[model samples]
Target: MASGDEPSGELASSLRAIGARYQELSQFPTVTHAALGAGHATSAGGQTFPLYTECSQPDLARRRRLRFSRHYSVHRSPGSAVSVSRAALSAEIHHQLLGQLSPTGQHRAVLTRCPGLGHELLEVWGSTGRSCSVDLTALGKHGEVYKEGPFACLTWSHAEKQLLYVAEKSQPRPQPLFSWDAPGAARPAEEEEEEKGEQFLYHEDWGEALSTCSMPVLCVLDIEESSVTVLEGVPEDVSPGQALWSPDDSGVVFVGWWHAPFRLGLSACSNRRSGIFYLDLSNGRCELLSAEHRAACSPRLSPDGRRLLYLEGAVGGPHRQCLQLRMITWHTRLTATVLDVVQEPTDAFAGIYTDALPPQCWAADSRRALLSTPQRSRTDLLLVDTEAATVMNLTAGLPEGCWVLLTTQWDLLVATCSAPHQPPSLVVGVLPPAGQELTLHWVRAEDAPPVPGVSWKTLTVQVPCGEQSPPPCGTRAFEAVLLSPPAGAALHPLVVCPHGGPHSVFDARWRPTTAALCQLGFAVLMVNYRGSLGFGQAGIDSLLSRVGEQDVTDTQLAAERALESEPLDRRRVALLGGSHGAFIALHLLARHPEHYQACAVRSPVTNLATLLGTSDIPDWRYAALGLPYSFERVPRAEDLAAMLLRSPIAQAPRVRAPVLLCVGARDRRVCPTQALEFYRVLRARGVPVRLLWYPEGNHALSGVETEADVFGNCARWIIRHLGQPCRAAPGQHSP
Candidate 1:
């Protein structure tokens, strides 16, 4: 087949023969439709897991009836049995299928199915917790409820029985505003130029009275009355975090962080702080309860409505560096007292401070409470005896994990544990009599794809640095699943796949794209470099300013180690990544062009200055890059230049490898302008580069057509640049 060409019948037959040979030699398992069901039902000594899906005639019929897998399945019982209601069918399917799959009875159901909103549906978990659908499409456009799904929070008024929803509606071309409403409300007229001007005039005159100055307002919908009202207004400069309704639905609490302003002719603001505000729904009055707290976050109300439990500060920093479980008494006018503080001096940063604080739920008596301890490197489940002021650790051995506690009459907890290279599994257990120790019971283990013809091992090596102790580097080593071809595949190509999230570690999850690469004949090496989370704060801190230097060294070292056991074509190695991974790819091409034949980068950060200025997230640029918030308070130009030198765009001309840059036009996280500017510079410098822009995508390429284009183009690019024929020809598809 020619480059980018689809095979004809004759070519297909030839390719099939080649595929068959590899299939035989590699022992690639034939994955049939029947085999697609649950594999290897192993019990951890528990009741037979509730089966979520059954091999039934209805399932078969539904499968055959639908042309696509996205369609919903309809089941009919034999012998003309009474027809089940749609709700009953959904409940039965989830109960029988998911209940069997997961012993904890924890499953999510997507009820609303809107295609334009990309199957926008409510995701209902358990029987209570209701979260709105936050899918990009749903959050971006305003329209009818497109999909049917479970809701995180659904409340029907005891009086009105009307349903209120926290929803998004598209305004103009670029803005999405969160609004409060009930079903079947009349739509507001689109704001026109004349109307906008008049509104602005009115806003300038009575903005404060009407709460129009607020960027986003907290709203409450009285379902029975079909009335919507703004409960509170978010301050202009502060970024809102989470909002929660009071148990009685008479009040709302929201958390937000405000950036400290830079003083003229002085250093930039050094402190980052947040506050919790309580809004009275009856009167639209807002008051700050903990206005003095710095960096306090994740406030949860106690069961009795007498106290609040929250995390104070960033948890482990120069600031309040302790994870203190605080209690606030409403009787004391919302005064807070620190109850128990979790901190370790040996920890580079107090570990508990960085952990996320989940919701606090009460035990049956409402005296004992269960709350997730802030996750250290590993998560620890904690049972707090409120009256006794004592804390007990549960699930101590599980490292780098998360847990959910269901405080039903019987206290049941489900925990998921995982490490750098271990696939995660769900474990269920019950709290002991005294709520001290946990009685462990295995529930279900995640089924990881068996690695064919490969054995995997892990190794830690010391990377030497001049006059200093070499940084400890860890990697998981695995043999290639596909064997070399008869020509012995002597010059087998290698791929250096760096994961996104400079701080996110790589784990042993089943990634379809990664497996596809292996099936297409490539040896892939994924690296979890320094600054990755779950390894402790020191590891994460190491990558703060030294992003490219050490990470690149580790990547190169990993490649060298991989080459020791296999014959690799040094000249044919390529670097591929997305998001922050894309940043590393660009950095590699710029700093070590000769090391890679080509590079593919998606949604990469090109210019640090532009990134800081235009990123959707406020204060992230300053915090992540260790930069001052405002330019006026920044250091001298020389110092700024030194910092900017580390940016990818600055070193673009030094990139000798062919480049493929992909970006999403609607990506708010990493603006498309970054890619556009980088491509512009590369072309100006006469570098061989291809730029692909997806107008409909955001940070992720999700649509089927977009994903096909990305993968197909990437494969074709690799083959063309490496002097190999492509399976899909140019005219066959558009990249």
Candidate 2:
């Protein structure tokens, strides 16, 4: 190993190799968005239609990502149960951002962000070869267009004359501390006063990735009139978004998130208190359409426009939980009826676990909707009958992997499917008639180049049952996906990976890190321990209050079981994780020092007590410890002690493995100080440790260049430590 902070020659070589491998993987573009065209035709071979998909891939040369739409003639094969030929690319549209097709399909609305110029451009392109552009920043000083969260939306009116979207509410222009207006430039004293105090006033945003989204409001654009209007009647406390024009265009339906108690981290959190509401344009009245107290979003209207479908989960609980499908009947202009489509799961189905539904999810029948949700270790596309309250797994016949529903138009459905060892490939399927088993014959719309030398399988690890053992109420059995090179080779080094979210599940989908490591002859074990989602709410609730003990034990047991079962070198095992996963990884390293040769973590939760006051999701710290959170609740001595006791910092003294800490300096979810504290402890103890700080990276460290650097360095770190034998210190013992 190198004597100082700089990487060794071997480490540099491995980093370059890993970077090149990742760049190779980036060549396969994944389908990001799909839009079906107006015409639908049936061919004798099977079926054919015009499909438009927005594909994205990392442009390594430019150090950025490139997104473009491809038009294709998708043809399905009749001989196969459900399969499509790799459709030839018919046409390509480049430099389009957030394109929304009009109802009549004769026009398209495009919203593009020009960060370099510090503004946004909205363009409307008509089929007749005419297009108009509007500089949103200049139009009315409406804030940047929302690109994420429940507030992110771009929809067209049925008449195609208007467009509805969400944007941040304009803020008062800042004024000098002491300035006098010219004699001719007289301004109202009240308006001038409003700008004075706003210069440095504190304003809370939606949290993390949504830093600029402090106050979101619905906005409508009149194409012909060249005007933009911020819809009224929305309560000041409510942040309205996901707005869509109502059936007759008399009103707009939207989801409103209340900013009362406070805004917790909204990224990947689905249980924020919100509801579906309708804003009447004529009366300027906003009426709550769904249960006001329940958490709801993704208000999708049916094909016939008489029904409204949305998802609801319990409020003030887990950050993410199983959602209950619901449909509301628009009986009259004044009244509506609510129906519980899938309130709970049946024997075969687990529950609905999805952040959002596709924009074009409804089928031609107006009752069935296509949704992809986590089911165990894989994501399955399900055909949901809103009226019948029945669910069918549409992708059950596919290989054990993830099948994500992208969009649907008429009877046509588009999705991207992939396995742990495969890259994402676009597939198209036509919905079958109602009351029939949905054996969707999926046709490959776009093919991803096959990844060589990688193979994977799912392994089930049953939680040990005993009186002294932790309660097995939620997770009786968990699973892990192990990816490795082809068989008949030397036993490979193993990397035990635990996922963050403790509530989030690790799907058996293609990941660049896993692929790169597997290709480099390292077997990667991705453990979806007890607390992971897709197993059920019981499994998630089971780990509460038992974070360190239960999660640590579960991961250790899963790793040990894999070591015993698979052809992996027991002595050459390392740990890799992020956030909560990193917390578990550190615990495993500290408690079972002899088992792991090294450890690499990203923005780990080292000391929960210290993080409670710093993290954006302080509520998560409380919820993980089987406690509820409130802004008014003060942390007592015992609470802080309990938090530290369950955190990895308490066990840091026992950790002997060489460690690599990757942290984003700007991370708000888990502060960078958490990694620093751990690094200091390990360095003080004379443990070989290195910390890589990304100045501009956030909690996820998900930037294209940042991720490449992280993964490449992580590979180098693991390789260096795994090449040598790891021995525990004189006093340490495996748990």
Candidate 3:
């Protein structure tokens, strides 16, 4: 045996440092936290339960989940309406969660797990309304959830004893920084003065891309044994997402994603294809359902096993208002049902739902269904009459700021409700039977944090119509909400905010940042531009191929219209946005240079042409740049040329507004290189620009401390650029 007589303390120190880094990476599990319980009216002895999860942060860096169960008895109304407020509700966020009641209502099952993050554990519970406590520690590798897959979720079996979920087996390992085997001839360099420094091309596309070696598989965890079984027959090439067992638990239906020879970066794009696949448990064979030439996801099987409901759309497509949620007959005994919506709406399916929409209990006839939708910039419950082929708004009388999170057993609705001056509160409302009117029973959570005093009102901004003539294309109108601080001696600075997705909307939901800004004496105009959802198809269609141009005009006109009514300082106006919202902010400042003073953007898309090659949503450039996106191929040179012309980078030289860029170093959807390039260009030109780097941040740049830094800097930056920071109490406006 050979031995080193002398100890090398230096080598030991280096080895320990590497081990510490590995441990830190391992601890970053994709864990979701939660708290609270929701309930609804239920039948005698046979009741339904709504489980709530809360993330209790003992430290800014670590999080844990706590579960709550509140039962609503069908025989009686629990209490007089329990009124909940908004400011108190917005602080709760949980990871992918599933909650339901057992057949006898004697027990309930709640499952919660975090996605994309590593080392986090899934929290499971079996409660009986009175007592249910199971220690979830010291579980072996069979129960661990890691970070390599495209998606993961936790659900309960029909019997409520076994847990079924989508799991990815391959553990992600650290890859080498660069490939070392390549050898190429060097080109002769021109004099630095003669050459324009060869524009620094970018190649940061893969940071957010899925690892090639990883794939998703369906797995079942036995609650009693704590052992796992990877389902057989799942293809190596197909990665599955969000799945559910058939009503009888005889089959598993899930979303299947097949990769092409070439991969797109993380920015969600319409060109990627997905379909619904079903695995017959008896035979262990997987078969493709409909969804060809369409991206399908979030499949739900009716309890009676008579029908299936799922969403079909170009998820990242420009048709902001066109995603559809359709229902198909599921009688295998008869012929396979054709693709069709049991009830199709005149307007495109809208609101925030793919997987977020909770499956409601089937009507007594087992035909009609209940669900929530985003309509007219507000979240509402819609009861779908499958046979009648019509949709009804159950909560039509609810206030404007009402946003539904998800529904629970026996028609219990969980939502966030608020009015201009009211802070958001956790709302628990009961839905009356079909023919009767709907009323809400709410609960006011104690020890809730206070929201800043702010008042809001709805307003519409009108922009010019058609092209050449007086009646070529009609004028379009957009709706927005004006949020303001208490009246002061002088008018406050106006900050125009835009929503991302380019296709998304700025709805009545309570935004903590918006309230914070109002507290600092600012008037905020949140624009629901032409491309926003909730409007009719005509409104969303107007922005199809007119992204940079039409969206820019809409934002500018909305800002001008808002200033007309609000008492805001015209000279002290500022612009803010993230993602595509940031794209609009930058272009507005460049095209109409004097329209705003300073601009602040987080993860803004600077160059569309560059993004075509480096962004996770590679096809996004083609679609947003006015060309149809091809599912399997990257855009050609001509398509890229058009993108370059439409990007904000083309007008960067015209921007005179001082700019601040916030970036996440670990973002996969939109890389940080875009910001680096923008920062470099501005610095080189001697323009006023600042860049803030979040070393371990992702696309949102979020964390307890990181978010505070990002939003705090945002408000402070605007105040500094606008004029002065005022700190007088409400009604004590600065003189």
Best by TM-score: 2
Instruction: Report the poorest 10 consecutive residues by lDDT, candidate 2.
Output: 726-735
> Clash pairs of candidate 2?
82-441, 82-442, 83-441, 83-442, 83-443, 84-442, 84-443, 84-444
lDDT of 2: 0.80
lDDT of 3: 0.59
Report lDDT (Cα) of residue 95, candidate 3.
50
Q: Compare candidates 1 and 2 on TM-score and give the better one.
A: 2
- Encode model 2's per-residue lDDT on 480-533: one tens digit a residue: 999876665467789999999878989988787788788777889999988777
The better-scoring model by TM-score among 1 and 3 is: 3
Whole-model Cα lDDT of every candidate shown, in order: 0.47, 0.80, 0.59
Q: Pairing residues by index, what is the TM-score of model 3? A: 0.77
Tell me the tens digit of each residue's lDDT in model 1 across 421-471.
Answer: 223333344445664355544343222233332222333334544513344
How far is 701's C-alpha from truth in model 3 (Å)? 1.4
- Top candidate on lDDT is 2
Please give the lDDT score at residue 366 for candidate 3: 57
Better of 1 and 3 by lDDT: 3
